[model samples]
Target: MVVTDENPSAAPVTVPVAPKRRLPGWARSVLWAVGVVAVLSTASYLTGVNTLTSTNTAQIALRLALPILLAGLGGLWSERSGVINIGLEGMMILGTWGAAWGAYHGGVWAGLGAAIVFGALGGLLHAVATVTFNVNHIVSGVAINLLGLGVAKYLSTLIFQPLSGNPRQSPPVPTFDTYSATFLSDWLSGLEQQQRVGISDAAGLLNGLVTGVAPLTMIAILLVPLSYLVLWKTRFGLRLRSCGENPVAAESLGISVYRYKYVAVLISGGLAGMGGAALVLLAGGGGYLENQTNNRGYIGLAAMIFGNWRPGGLLGGAALFGYADGLRLSGGGKAVLALMYGLVLLLVVIVVVQLIRRQWLAAALGVLGAGVLYWIYWANDDLPSDLTPYTAHFVTLIVLAAASQRLRPPRADGARYQSGQR
Candidate 1:
């Protein structure tokens, strides 16, 4: 800050004051998300696009988002520790088999436990190949993927064929108990039905959160904050991340680069295993089946990339894709077309934000995009049937394109590391 001198003939004197502190990166991201949500909710309320905030849509979104959330978190753990875990899919596959085997022989909790162990094993294998033997990270990951698939298949045929009467699937696994905050949900439901703009919008969202959520859902949601605390706030996290950024420097500091990398990879596997168990217990309904993962591991990796390798960013990415998936399943093309309208609103909001930041070119592009999208929305009653199935992928591409400019990975995220070597 500056102030002028009182003397008429005196030159103005500059005064210094402390600059205002800016919000942290995570906080800013959250605020941006909240702003976008507000725009979307208002669009829903005005356009009669109820599906955008419907309880059913929200519920399904939670279910779909869980695996991706976990998988992306897994990638974070590995990458932060200086290892790129492209084997997340393989780990998930191992987890599926472990879950089925444990659930069949023990119970649901046992299944979850077994999955973690199995996933950890896959992680261990990755560590052996990449760290101990100096194998290429991508090559090690690909080998693990094939190995996991083959192992799952062999185990399934040997263990599940007689019991399930099918080689490709397992018998039903008992699901966990579910609970709801009935009172809050009821109140919110009532308010939502009243159709009062922001009030209804808040009620709808709160209602979805409080109504009929599984214990695993709560656990999955909690992991995001827990991860941020551990990875960003703790000393251990700093050391682990150091290995990713500069393993040689970390080793020089006696940080034990190999140890941190190993730990991170194992944790990565365990998280991915949890993702698999989530799929079987929460969404599968049936115990386990062949190819049940449905490439969610790959999608999770995409979510991780979209988030620029941050926990909060990945969470937002996962939720966006999940919402699109659920929308396609529940409302078909009309709901998707409704989403296009909401996107236009969101783009307009983006334009306003860009203008505030004096980003003229970006604001201009946003305006052009919004105009084109709204024109498309106005001309179409529904999306073509052929395009309906790729809704999640479509959204993922757009988001990645929008966010790609800002993404930065760890310095040595996928680089080969050697002890005491730069």
Candidate 2:
């Protein structure tokens, strides 16, 4: 009976909760991107290899990014509706043909409209197969790809061949020479020349930003924000997203899954078509070639994944890919060499840090990464032009490997939906 009655109400032990120690993924990505850009800018200034710092490079990067951005946005819309659109390439090819036909007959504006129509047609076809008929998504996409290229080639032979005397390409299209006034272009151009005279490096970078920019470039840039607002802040977007994530639940809530999916897919096609029109406009004198798309549709898909299907994230991914492409166009300059070496140096430091922390596996991987960069640096002078286009892909692969764990696709995506199947 003398058992020490444990104080039933003994003071509750208070363990202090640890505050969040890690930065959000976006914040960390921003810091890393800023550091990389700063390093490259300094290298360009120090070496006087202005290609890396020139505004022309910036313009080229933006142009290169635009089509990818459009396609990525299209993919976002389609996939967000629980339908995978692997036929973006096919849609883009169709758009390219449409643009060529429209430009050849009328003008750039007409070409844009034609492209949208063609893309919508492709989207309708895809929806019929994947949504209405419940065909395998991947199979439908593959069939679309083959059919698109064949159709484009057939049309090219009939229309472009008869008109331009060449079946493989279309004649040049009219281009917008400048968005800014003459005075602004002159000022920026003058400042660009002064870069060699010790003016700010940014001056060179601004020279190409405004002068000779196409109207489509401006439109594409505007679409980024417009898409963000429509997809994230609007009621329709919420309903569309619900269909993708949980169609059964959405049906129970009185949402029309089929209607949303159709709209999304069509919108996706229209966006991809716009990308094709932009590509033709970007080519200007070069015009549209039989294989002008060069696999950009697939790249757009990769960008969508890299961005985790967000508009803002797609912007950054597009910029990275575009910058790499611009660098490739520069043809292995000293600035690029410096950048590669700098990356190697950073990886070496990471290896050291990992070793100090006794992270044997991580340190080994860091060593491997450093070695790869060193080899790329060693081969820079003799690197094949054919390999240049793949630099963006390499960077993307590395990023995906490092961060894919954090990415979460919409639930129920690609899953067949039947009413009351819950």
lDDT per residue (tens digit) for residues 1-422 in model 1? 65677888887778888899999986898787677668768778767888877787777888888889999999999998878888999899998889878877898889899999999999999998898888999999889888988999999999899898999999888876778898888898999899887778767767877887888889989999999999999999999999999888888899998899999999999999988888887754548788878778888988999988989989988998888898888788888888888899889878999999999999999999899889988999888989998999878788888988899999989898787785
* TM-score, every prediction: 0.92, 0.86
Q: Per-residue lDDT for 15 in model 2?
A: 62
Q: State residue 315's C-alpha deviation in candidate 1, in Å.
A: 1.6
Each model's C-alpha lDDT? Answer: 0.87, 0.79
The number of the candidate with the highest TM-score is 1
Q: What is the lDDT of residue 397 in candidate 2?
A: 77
What lDDT, from 0 to 1, does candidate 2 have? 0.79
- Residue pairs of candidate 2 with colliding backbone atoms: none
lDDT of 2 by residue, 1-422 (tens): 12333787665556667787998756977786656556556666654566776777777777888888898888999999999999999999998889877876788888888989998899899988988888888899888878888889998898788777999887777644446556876877777777553344555555666766788888888988898788789999899999889898899999989999999999999988888887886644336688888888888887888888888778778887777777767646454565566667667767888899999998898889878877877776645666666777776777677558668778877877665677
In model 2, which regions exceed 4 Å deviation?
A: 1-8, 11-33, 45-48, 181-203, 283-286, 333-336, 345-364
Instruction: Point out where model 1 deviates above 4 Å.
Output: 1-20, 25-30
